[model samples]
Structure formats: structure tokens, C-alpha cells
Target chain A: MEAGKRINVVTKILAANDRVADENRRRFAELGLKVVNLISSPGAGKTALLEATIGRIRKDRRVGVIVGDIATTKDAERIAKHDVPVVQITTESFGGSCHLEASTIRQALDEIPLKELDLLFVENVGNLVCPAEFDLGEQAKVSMLSVTEGEDKPLKYPLAFQVANLVILSKVDLVPHLRVDMEALRANVRQMNPKVRTLELSSQTGEGFDAWIEWLKKP
Target chain B: MHEASIAQNVIESVLRLIADGTVQGKVARVYLKVGKLTAVVPDNLQFMFGVLAEEGPLAGVKLEIEEVPIRVRCKACEEAFEMHEEIRLICPKCGSADTRFETGRELLIDAVEVD
Candidate 1:
């Protein structure tokens, strides 16, 4: 049968990773925990936003965080200040993956006291392109886009905006210091993903944080 | 960047098919349909596929990637359109940001040719 079998198979390239993602989803669903895969480009303020969000919302909601990185444990250390159960997954062993796969999330889920938390924030490694392609079994995909990046970022990285459930425009307090067009950024995001909700936030000054705090509390 | 890993995944998938010992000869070509919105550069992915698919059932196998353009349906006017330019997604007719995408996020292998 090895001469000319010519069998046809239609398969998705990411099927293995996606299988683990679905498993992670079911696992979270069983534990009654909501998972949010937070993605962004480097220096998009994902860590600071998580720090601020966890600091504010952890009082009312039990939150757990899993930080994914290529080589550093620094972000996990930053989030540890909130006195929450934080797990760090470093991809250095696995060829330093640019994005977090569901298997890594599963491993991290095993490390954390998942049942004790209401929400689990899986902070994906900072990359606009790759992270948006993988579903880490999160209930929602959030991207923190810093105003310093540029107004044309949404147009350049449309997949990130397109897949995001919420695109937080971080570092907006610095808009005055820069020539960034905030209106154009928001409009581009709205045009890219009309279903995505957006917010402007500055983790430094805590401006426009109340809405995010409230958003976290909603069922 | 991730295309190399993605290309490896594609090869792994094809190798799994021939592992059953049904494939007749050396795999000639693997036909793939990748969406423009998936962020996969066809040339880059094909390059990686070439490097990784060596020394196996997939050795010298050509990767044929069919790029699909982004198609959307305007939520306001209910009109469908294909967008080729990388710009703000707006309905040419109704100018609505609230448009639903019909296609352009696929990354799948549709068929394989085995000699």
C-alpha cells in the first residue's frame, strides 16, 4: 500500500494546540473560573494594567494570575505585590515560544489554587501577532494597546484588534506629551472589530479605571 | 516568527497521515488555504516548511499556499465586500464599523499529493 495510496486528509495545522485549548476551557468551566487571556505588544502596559486591575478588583473578586514570558520572572514578581496566587510559565525550555499555548496554561492551572479564584488572568507573552492566533482557553481575549505605539497600530496589527474582546488603550495619560491621535486610534479599533469594547486607561494616574473595575465585577 | 513553528505543525500533520502506511510514495505537494488575516506570510511559511520537511516522507514536498482575501458583511447595510487593502474596515456603502466578517481567518491543509 506504500506505492501510490494517495490518501487525502484535511487538517488544521493548530489542531493539537486547539485541542488543548478546548480542554482548558472545559476545565475552567468545571471549576467555575473565568479565564481571560491578556495579549499585547511589548511595553503595551499589560503587566501594569494587570497590577492595577488586580489591586482594585481583588478586594471584591478573588483573582489569580498566570504570567507567560520568554525568559524573565519579572512580571510575576510585579504582580506578586498584590498578595495573590501567581504562577509563572517560562517558555525557555520549549524553544522560547512567542505565545502561550493551552498546554502551558493547563500546567499553570495545576500550580494555582484554581478553585479559590473567581477569575484567572493569563497574561500572554508580549507580541501582537502570535498571541492573537492561539486561543489559550480564555473566556475573553484582552489587548492593552499603549498610546505611545501609534494611531496606525490597529491598522497594522488588525488581527490583534480583531480578536480582542476588549482593547484597552493604555498609557492614555501621556497623550498630551505625544502627537498620537487618540480619536483615530479608537476609530480604527472600532472599524476593525465592532463587537470589541474599548477603554482608555492610565495605570500610572489611575484615570478611567472605575469602568474597568466595574467591568471586572460583572457576570 | 511563529510561521516556522506553524510550518512544523503542518508537516507533523501530514506525516501523521502517512504514518498509517497508506500513502503510495514520497509526498509531492501539500495544498494549504491560509487567510490573509491570519498573519501568516506565505513566503516565510513556505521557506520554513522547506527546511523542516527534509529527510522524511515529506522530503522535497512543495507547499502550495492559497491566500484568501478578507471578506466582510456590513452590519448596517447588509452588504458583502472583499477588502484587499490593509486599511480601516469600513463599508463603502454604509460606512459602518459594525461589520461582520464572513471569511479570512482560515489556516488549514485541504489536500496532499503523494507519489
Candidate 2:
């Protein structure tokens, strides 16, 4: 070995994770499943939205959910009440992983009936930044922002908004009470991602769920 | 926060490379190219890498990071530019809202220097 010799190894640091994510993507495709990775900050209404979404779509489409959390199985329990196949991935055992990686998703898939479901939702751990960096092999990455969290979230956390395929303004029913500007939020999201779709909905009142369901049903 | 996991991944990547004979001898430094858009804090990443690599063959490995700026191309006018201040996707040249990111999402291990 020569002194101070350098080798060019231009590759992704997360290459291993990315490879597994590609595998998960293939698996999803083989099962003809539309996979969506839902990302958001804590208390952003992901579970509530899923409960509402499953209630609406379960009548026509078979749905499954993989919920990731730092400690509790509370989210998985919530989704399981909807009578859909649900898997809880508690990251506390995995060194409290802040983000749900591809390998985790791969393992969770074994617990669910993949072929029997028309759609699968990976409710990523509630943290906008880390989850945006990890690819869970989902067809779409739907990032959520509640009106209660304020409109500047997209600007403050640009990467989450930038990577999102669809930005959902959750808890919109309480917008009138909050000082958050909905239009500014949409504009901020657009500033990060020009072509990404935006939607507003409230799981409490089911205000904009029709559009959400319609978006889900799109080919 | 997530830098610990990322640092672990970097170590794993280097170890794999060494095991496969792509990286030879004592690893001295690992060069990384992280895009600005990535939420990674370089200082935190360096610290975590040092801690994670302390007991292994990568002990005392110096992690050198090169941050790449966010760059985007306008779809309407076909002009490209780099964003220095705030990351806005709109094209600076044509002022078109239709634009796409060209760079700044990278998280690559560019190369390594060994003794």
C-alpha cells in the first residue's frame, strides 16, 4: 500500500438502503399495489387521516398499513381498529431509529397480505426531516402539514416539502381559528417543489377527503 | 439526530469496500459530497463518524465533507441557476414557476485516502 493513496469510490453512502428500497419497489409493483409513504412532523394528523382514509376506501379497496413510531404501538392499534391489516414498527428496539428505512419496510411486508391489498400505506415516523432522507420504496411520498403547525413549515423544512409528491394541509377545519395562511403555505410548498400537488383536508370533519380519495383512486 | 445512522452507513460502506478489496490498507480519510438540500449537519456527522469508527479499522478516520449547493433548471425557459440564500424552485432567469431541481440532493461517498 502506497502512502496517502486515494481510491475513487463515488457511490451513495445510503446505497445499501437504496438497493433495498428498489427491491421493495419491485415487490410492490409485483403485487400491483400503490404504496404511499406518509411523512410529517409530530401531531400532524397522520393516524387520523389514515383512519379516515381507510374508512372511506376500505369499502371498495383492500388497504394495509405499516406504522412506524419511536416507542408506542398506539398508531398501529388505531389503524387496526379500521379492520385493515396493520403492522407496528417500534423503532425503540432498533436504536430508536428516527426514520423508517427500506429494510424495515421489507421486514414489515412479510407480516401483511401483500397480494390481497390494492393499496399499502407506510405511515412513516412523525418527523419531517429524517423521513424525507430515507426512501421507503413508495410510489408517492405524501408530506403533511397541519394548519396548527403554521404556514412557514414548508420554508423552515424545505427538504420535506421538496421531496413530497403531494403536500397535504391537514387539520384544515380549524384554519379559521388559527393564524396560518393557507395560500401562503401552498405557495411556500410550491417554492420548494413547483410541480407537486397540494391538498387541504380535515380528518375530524372530512372536509376535503373527497379530493383526497379521488387522488388516491387516480391511475 | 439522523446523522448517527448516516455515519453508521458511511462506516458500513467503507468497511464493505475494504472487505471487497476496493479499499486497501489503513483508511485515513473518507471524502463525502453532501448536497445543501440534505438536512445533514456536517459537524454532527463528523462527530458521529468519529465515535462510530473509533473501535474499528476506520479508527481516527477523518470525514471530509463537500457541501453542494442547490441548483435547479427552468422548464419553461431552459435556464439553470444555483440558489445561495433561500431555496426557491422558481427559475431566476425567466421567473417561471415551472422548475425542477438539478442538484443538491446528493449524499455520496466520493472517494477515500488510505495509508
Candidate 3:
């Protein structure tokens, strides 16, 4: 007989990931809880944005956070200062996994009292690359890029920008000092993601935060 | 960093297939069709699979990853060719940015062979 070859297995992998992601999304929908997956490069102010947003919204909405980091509970520690339920998933526990998997998120969900919360924010590990590829069962995925990070970031890392429903331009307070062209950044973002809502705000001064809060409040 | 997590997804899927009578034990190889535009690092995925599978049901299964390059067809000239990264959308033949991407965003388990 001619040499018999083995069948390929890539389809099985993606199908399984999609099925689990769908299951997780369905569960979130059932709870009527809007889960937001927050992604960005390190120091893009993901934690700061979370703190500010949580401080603004937590008064009316029950907010919970699952923070992912490579090491230390630094981000989780900062988020815990806001007095909301927080869980930290270190990469070390999962053999240095950069993004939270559906199974991991499912376990984290078990830790949270879903009925008691209106929104669950998963602050994904601060890397623009790997986190964008995996879906964490979120109702919306928000990519945080700082003004200091430059405008070309979205064009360079197109996948992250393309997958996000919203792109928050964090640390706008530094815009005056930095040379970031806000208009060009917005244009590039619009080119990559036409429908992605862009918000420019400073977590420190609280500028443009109201619109962000209102955006999150909308159904 | 998330490569291992993605590999875990692959392993989980293969196991489910086995449980559902899709495949048998002792998988020889797993083939993946990954697109360049998908941003998945194939080496990281293979490394992840190797590490995770050492203790799982997919133990000893070989990983085969193939890259699928993006191709675009120009709206103006109807020219189809492989996309060059330096020039994202402009058609090389006609130098028009009005083109629709044909491929390069697939992430799928094409097939698996098991004992």
C-alpha cells in the first residue's frame, strides 16, 4: 500500500476553544452581567483606568475584577484598594500563560458571586500580542493604549486594536508633554477598527471619564 | 505567554474528540492551519503543546503547524497576490489600496491522526 498519512488536528483545537468561549459567554449573558476583558501593554494604565472606572461605577453597579499578571499581586493589590472583589491569576500558576483561558475564567467566575455583581472586569495580562487572540468570554473587549505609547501602536499591533469594541486612550494628561498626535491616532484606530469607540481621558484629572462611564452604562 | 493556554485548548479538544468517538488513544500528530494575520506564534504554540501534553491524554502527540499567508484582491484592478507586510493593502499590480483581503485569519485544527 502507498504510505498512509495522518489527518490534521488544527480544526479540533479551534472548535473546542470556540465552544468553551461560547459557553462562557452564554453564562455571562444568563447572569445579565457584562464581562469586560481589559487588554493592553504594561504601563498603559489598565489598572488605573479600572480604578477610576470602578470608583465611578461601583456606587451603583456591583463590580468584580479578575486581574492577571506575570508576577506579584501588584495590579490586583492596586485594584483591591477600590474595595471591590478581586482575584489575581499569576502566570506562574499556569506555566506562565499570558492570557486567561476560558477554563481559567470559568474557575474565576466560580469564585465570584455572579448574581451579586452587574459587571465583571477581567484585567488581562499586559501584553498586546497573545491576549488578543484568546477570547475570555467577555461581553466586550477593551484595549487600553496610552498617549505616551505613540499612535503607531495600533497599526503595529493590529489584532488587538481590531478585536476591541472600545479603545481607551489612557493618560491623556501627559499628552501636552508628549508628542502624540491625537487626531492621527484616532484616524489610525478608525482605519483599523471602524466601529471601535475611542475615548481620550486622564485617569488622574478624570477628564472624559463621564462619557466613558456613560458608554459602559448603556445597554 | 498565552501560547500554553491555546495549546491547552487544542489538547482539550482532542480529548473530547476521543471521548466522543472521533479519535482513538495515542494520537500521532495534530495539524493546525494558522494564518499569519492571526498573530499566533507557531513556535510558542508547539512549545506549549509539548509542555502541557507531557502529563495529559495528548501525551506524545506531535504538533504540525502550517502558516496561511494573507492574500488580497484589488477592487480596482482585480489583481490577486500574496500580501506583503511592508505594503498592507496597496495592490502591487495597480498600486490601489482598495482591495479586499482573501485569507490569513484562520485558526483551525485541520486534522488529527491517532492510533
| TM-score of candidate 3 to 2 decimals | 0.86
Model 3 gets an lDDT of 0.81
User: Largest DockQ belongs to which candidate?
Assistant: 2
Off by over 4 Å in 1: A1-8, B19-25, B75-78
Error of model 3, residue B96, in angstroms: 12
Per-candidate TM-score, first chain only? 0.95, 0.97, 0.94
lDDT of 3 at B77: 94
The collision pairs in model 1 are: A2-B24, A3-B24, A4-B24, A5-B24
lDDT of each: 0.86, 0.91, 0.81
lDDT per residue for candidate 2 within A1-219, as digits (tens), equals 557988999989999999999999998888889999999999999999999999898887899999999998999998888889999999998889898999999999999999899999999999989999998899999999999998788888889998888989999889888888788888888888888889989999999999999999875
Task: Score candidate 2 by TM-score against the native.
Answer: 0.96
Chain B TM-score, one value per candidate, order as shown: 0.83, 0.91, 0.82
Candidate 2 chain A minimal-lDDT segment of 10 residues: A1-10
By lDDT, who's the top model here?
2
Candidates ranked, most accurate by TM-score first: 2, 1, 3
Per-residue error at A213 for model 2, in Å?
0.8
Please state the CAPRI-style docking class of candidate 1.
Answer: medium
DockQ (Cα-based) per candidate?
A: 0.55, 0.81, 0.45
